[model samples]
Target: MHIPELYCPIPSSVVVKDPEAGEELIRWGADQGFFSLDSDAANLVRAIDIPLWTALAHPMLKSADDRSFLNRWWTWGAVFEMRFDTNAGQELDGFFEKFMDSTARTQIRILSNNPPLRDGEDFSEPMDRTLVSLLRETEQRFGNPWRSRISRSLLASAESGVWEARANYLSQTPDFDLYQGLRRHSYGQTYITDCAMMAMGIDAEAKFLRHPVIEHIQYLVALYGGFVNDLNSLDRDLYANNRCSSVIAYRHQYGVTLDEAIRAVVDMCNGYLRSVLAIEAAMPDYGKYSFDDQEADQIDSFFYILKMLMRGNIDWYEVSPRYNGGWKPGGPIDPAPWG
Candidate 1:
């Protein structure tokens, strides 16, 4: 329950600099075609926000040496972003309704003839299919076959168990236990969606979790005890009737003063940083060398960015205030803080 004393090595640059590397990475990403968006589609997306595209693309290009994996990661990210944008207009009701409808059909097929299930029984099929369909529709609309193909490939890989191992590992980690507890108690229903969104953001079309990057992101979330990202958006979530893990967790489990909660949140972030440093130290030279120095730098920058944002300064563009407000504990505090 205490913060670990781990430390990640600091990298030179917070952002990528090599133009040739950038171009090659983009081209390779285009060729792999995992996302629903093509070069043209990616370009269109860039038009909406060039910085965001660069932030996403630069890391993939820097870390992944394998042309195939790099391509798949970019493609998957591109397509997923497109689908997310397309669905942005939808309210929670519409999103859930669509999700539920897709789940029902997929569940039926999974249970009816897929063996290991008796007739008329319920089963928890993976939610990747719903995500896949959404990405496919986005790709079809944009005519971005490269991105779509990568998405399909990623889905195939996930079905084969490439990501499950990672998921199982993270879910069982001690850090995740504290994180999940906070999520379940404070955040409410929004906790699951936030987790799913984070999952979607980093997952490669449901194929593989981009090891270090995904792990890094999750590490940060767990460090904040799974609420910082959702903190700013508390009002919106409440408006939309969304539940947040931190809100629930703080109220039911760790009922304490705002000062105490903030302290705990900061400690969690510190713990997360330590955990990453530990992982990096243990990572083999060429064994899981997909992530390079540039990627590590980005992780560091983003982590600090979140740290600063949680402390107070609001950057609506980079950090949506409605959705990025830091989490504060709720309910009556105990006379003494729980150790």
Candidate 2:
């Protein structure tokens, strides 16, 4: 592989449990009705240990069942991308038609308003049923407010998927600067942090959500994760002819070697990590927002999950076989180059 070692600054007390977590992953999937052993989605997960990734990303989970719910929930973004972002993916227009046409009636409601699932309600399409189930479960565990906040990020995630699909549809690669903006969302950080928050079962008032410092931390978490993904997947993305990577963007815009571009991207990621740390430390008093003890705890969880997001799964990226195969006939869905 041409990828060089990346310097990730954030720390994680990651404990990737052994065969036990793997076995429990199945039971958790079965209990939640999200993952299937024989499905294409199952084929996709074989490339990397997603359950382990989920566990590593959200260490706040104290229970086995909690870890599994989040592991499966975190994997849904990939499943959605494969369904709508891959070659066999639905037409871009149809994706909007299927998912975006109704501003409030369908998924937005399921995500934000969060109506209860009836005994057999087709609240969403078959694929999205899992997401709806996950969201409802989030509401049950956390509360209507927490679920609503998570829903907002998830809506952004879906829209970001559309942005990514749009970029893929265009013959030319997205503009370097514009792509960075899109990358912040397209790479799944928004939903990743939100999923972690849901698992932690934390909530904040509207003012905290709108606070500038809080917003900046959220932005840095997403930016840092996107850079981490771009750096690690550089080899696989190059083989697949996908040039939307920030590393490639730097190299393309400036006459730099691939190695230089990789280094520059790594430096950029480190900078974001430093920024998150500084911001977390210098967080202004929330007294201005009249934050209660519960809201203050929610703010603390934000920092915790932010650290987890900024930690960037570098361990998994190094080991997980992510689409690094070249000219291979077939591969598992998780690591497959295209999706």
Best by lDDT: 2
Best candidate per TM-score, number? 2
- lDDT of every predicted structure (CA atoms): 0.35, 0.63
What would the per-residue lDDT of candidate 1 be over residues 1-339, giving only the tens digit for each residue?
222221223332244333354345445435444323344444432222323323332332243333233333333433333332211233434543464355434533432334433433543432334334434443453344434343433333223121222222223222334435434222111222222222223222332234555545443543343344334333333333332224333433556764454455545555665665555445446324565553554444434433332232112223321122322233111000100
Over 4 Å off, model 2: 1-4, 14-20, 23-40, 87-124, 254-256, 284-298, 321-329, 333-339
Question: Tens digits of per-residue lDDT for model 2 on 209-300?
Answer: 67776777778778778878787666556655565778877888887898887888877888887877776676555443455554666777
Candidate 2, residue 21: Cα displacement in angstroms equals 4.0
The collision pairs in model 2 are: 44-333, 44-334
State in Å the error of residue 23, model 2. Answer: 5.3
TM-score of 1: 0.37
In model 2, state the lDDT of residue 150.
Answer: 71
TM-score of 2: 0.78
